[model samples]
Target: MTAPRRPGPAPALDLAALVADPQTRIIVCCGSGGVGKTTTSAALALAAAEAGRQVVVLTIDPARRLAQSLGLVELDNEPRVVETPGSPGELSAMMLDMKRTFDDVVSAHSTPERAEVIFANPFYQALSSSFAGTQEYMAMEKLGQLRASERWDLIIVDTPPSRSALDFLDAPNRMSRFLDGTMIRLLTAPARAGGRAGVRIVGAGFAIFTRIISKILGGQLLNDISAFVSALDTMFGGFRERATATYELLRQPGTSFVVVAAPEPDALREASYFVDRLSTEGMPLAGLVINRTHPPATTALSATRAEAAAEAVAEAGGKGAKLAAGALRVHAERMTLATREQRLADRFTSAHPEVKVRTVPAAAGDVHDLEGLRTMGEALLAAEDDTGTGTPRSRVLPLRPQAG
Candidate 1:
């Protein structure tokens, strides 16, 4: 009988190559919330710039940490240069402003008078600011604008940290549906056909629909919605066409996706789903980054050994014995934590053996500066010898599942 093949470490993702390659014009970092997606995106852009590639990193998340890390007070729709030492190339970063981007799209596609009308509409104001899928749609629109400008050699996108990693991917389709849906067509019918004649073409159901909408939204709000839809009807086709083009852009050769996750069950599960979804949609997936991984200690002492040693020191009760016991106890706790983290990572690898992965060790504290981002970039490439002597004493180990 043939034996089952044992699971092994996944192929290492060459982060340096991914960032340094000139052909890679776009890199998207996507994952669940709190998985360090923003930091990873910044680090990659910083690394690419230092490697002599002009890079612009865009964050869809509204978090302020990205701005603070880059030593900037704030970030807006326009890119801001990050002044980091030893950066041979250039790096710029920006945060998406959904409303502003929508207005920009309107200004670009419509005549000055029409754009003014659209902008002044109350419904347009609400849709631009808080409508469902607005953020994702605006992110896509901004990306399209950046690509068309060809100002940067590479663009790194930090997708929104929503619960579903697919939110960004599904944005274009969702927006298109909302624009072309039955309700929108009905609302705009009267405006398109000129006066009440358009309402007669829409039949009896239109009357009932408008009546119900009027009851909920009042006459003024319904008129605002109708006027908004009528003015936007001409631009709807352009909106969908651009969205489709951007969706195709994501599937192009120059684009690559990096799935970021923490060394935990929930994060890894989400990463797995992202990997599968990318594959199903024929999107080019580069690999995964297991961030905040705990590296094992180099000392000969194991968790069991450290615990035993601590107990012995406590029992002996000699001078400095209490200090030694406390130190040993701390060591024991760290060792246990490192072991548990490794096991979780190991499980992820076992499930997705074909996917390449790079592990980034957990830092002592939060990354809050350009220098810290540079260090993170090095860790992502596995080229940092943080332990001194130009080499690390130990590497992060694979995590195993815990017993119930």
Candidate 2:
């Protein structure tokens, strides 16, 4: 009987090449919370800048990790240039201020008087700041604005840390639907009719309906919403149009989505969802990045053998033997952890064999500066074998002990 062939490692995701390509205008890093999406986006942007591409990274994460990593005091709605000494290209970074972005959209599309009316509305104030999906929608709006400017060769997007990774992809459509939905059209019908006709449009039946809605929503709140809708009546079509355009932009050839996840079951499952969604939406997917993986320093010694050696050394009971045994125990523990991580990664690979993947070993400390980011960037771009054994350069065995 013929033996079953063992599956080879997943195809390597050449992130370096992906960023270096002039045609790659946008790279969006998205995944579940605490998966290093912010760090990955910053590192890739720094790497691309050093490689001579004019790069801008926009982070929607509220944690401000990206600012710290980029060595910036603070980041706001506007793009701020990051000083990269001895680099061939320039880099800029920004954090999405959703409220400001929403205001900008209104001001840009509306007459000054009308914009003032919309901005001063209580409902608009609430909507711009804390409405459901506003942050995600504005992130898309900011991305669309950045792309339309044609100022940078590459735009790296760090998606928001939402409950669901799909929120980012769903934002534009959600916003478009909100603007064009039946209820919104009904609310603004009076405003569209104008003056006396506006009053006539809200006749006995409509007045009764409004009264019922007022009882449910509170009369003041409903009035505020009607006023807000009235002020925004002319700009609704513009909102829907821009949202549709941005959604289409995500599906274009120049854009690529990199799903980032840690080497754990839940994170990898989220990555799988994102990968499948990207395929369904026809978005260009660059690959998967498995971050903070615990690959063993040396795979030559199996965990079982390491444990046995440690036990034997401890039983011998020499002066330095205790220390040596401790070291061996530590190595054994590391090997065990690495094995678990690898198994989890393998399960993901088995499910998604065609997706290219790159694994980054866990850093000894958090990356909080440009130098640390560069180190992470190096690790991200490091080549790995077909067996996914991690970076070959760092996989050396321990040196032999000297005999006294």
How well does each candidate superpose onto the true structure, as a TM-score?
A: 0.89, 0.91
lDDT, candidate 1, equals 0.84
What range of 10 consecutive residues in model 1 has the weakest lDDT sum? 386-395
Best by TM-score: 2
Question: What is the lDDT for 116 in model 1?
Answer: 99
Worst lDDT run of 10 residues, candidate 2, spans 392-401
Candidate 2 structure quality by residue, lDDT tens digits, 1-404: 66644344677788888888999999999999888889999999999999999999998888889989999999999999999999999999999999999999999998999999999899999999998888877887899999999899899998876545457668767877887787687787765666886678666546877889899999999989989888888887787777779889889988999999987889999899988888998899988998897767667788899999999999999799999998888889988887777677767878888888888878899999999999999887765542344343222222223433
Native-vs-model 2 lDDT?
A: 0.84
Please state every model's RMSD to the true fold in angstroms. 3.9, 5.1
lDDT of each: 0.84, 0.84
Model 1 residue 393 CA deviation (Å) reads 12
lDDT of 1 by residue, 128-219 (tens): 99987888788889999999999998999988776554566777788778887888978876566655764676757778888988999898
